[model samples]
Target: MATQTAAERREDARQRYNAYVATCPSRKLLDTLSDKWVSLALTALAGGPLRYSELARTIAGVSQKMLTQTLRTMERDGLVSRAVTPSVPVRVDYRLTPLGEDLMPLLEAIKRWAEIHMEDVEAAREAYDRCSDSEP
Candidate 1:
């Protein structure tokens, strides 16, 4: 019988660690994607580039501060590209980068799933609320 060396055991552990990391979302990425503001902002940008005001208008209910913060984070993440063009006033536009484009399908699937299951989710929430309310 052959004995496993310590080096071989370490390599096996490293491989398992890498496999786990590959499947898990980074905290920052999850924070970005799970934000309500981020999701709405990405969806609005999906229509094509939009000016700040256009994004603000399209997203509805987003405060200027929240939108600005979300855009800044997205820009920092390389998920969005901001352009400023010469105009009567400085024209600023926001568009998705290649990485952002890559995320569109995933976002779209999430949107579709939410739309399809919202009623079910709401029903579950209501049932839970009723049960909890009755408990004490």
Candidate 2:
């Protein structure tokens, strides 16, 4: 039997969690990232830390329950930090952590790509529907 170095163990663990594998833990993270609420919240916080009410207002159409749930999930995943301030009304603020900051560029790029290509996507969808209608 041979002892593995720390780097080797880390690399082994990384290799084990392939997203393409059905049981890989990275799939869970991928699911989180694909969520609309998560993307919106992360991008909203990119400017700076936002109070809970501000976040709620910034992300219109998100119900209070969903917003709270999304924030809690992000916090648990170490993507965001929550701070509590003692005052007349206890204030809670959310800001992205270093790990979350590192993830921003990828999410931002995805957002940009989506915005840029949406018109093309819509045209494709319309063409597909027209073909389907003609075939039927």
TM-score per prediction, in order, is 0.80, 0.91
Worst lDDT run of 10 residues, candidate 1, spans 18-27
Backbone clash pairs for candidate 1 read none
lDDT of 2 by residue, 23-78 (tens): 99899999999999999999999999999999999999999999999999999999
lDDT of each: 0.90, 0.97
Q: Candidate 1's residue-wise lDDT over 22-91, tens digit each?
A: 5643545786899989998998899899999999999889999999999999999989999999999999
- What candidate 1 gets wrong by more than 4 Å, as runs, is 1-25
- Estimate candidate 1's alpha-carbon lDDT, on a 0 to 1 scale: 0.90
- What's the number of clashes in each of the models? 0, 0
Best by TM-score: 2
State in Å the error of residue 9, model 2.
4.7
Candidate 1 lDDT at 124 equals 100
Stretches of model 2 off by over 4 angstroms after superposition: 1-11
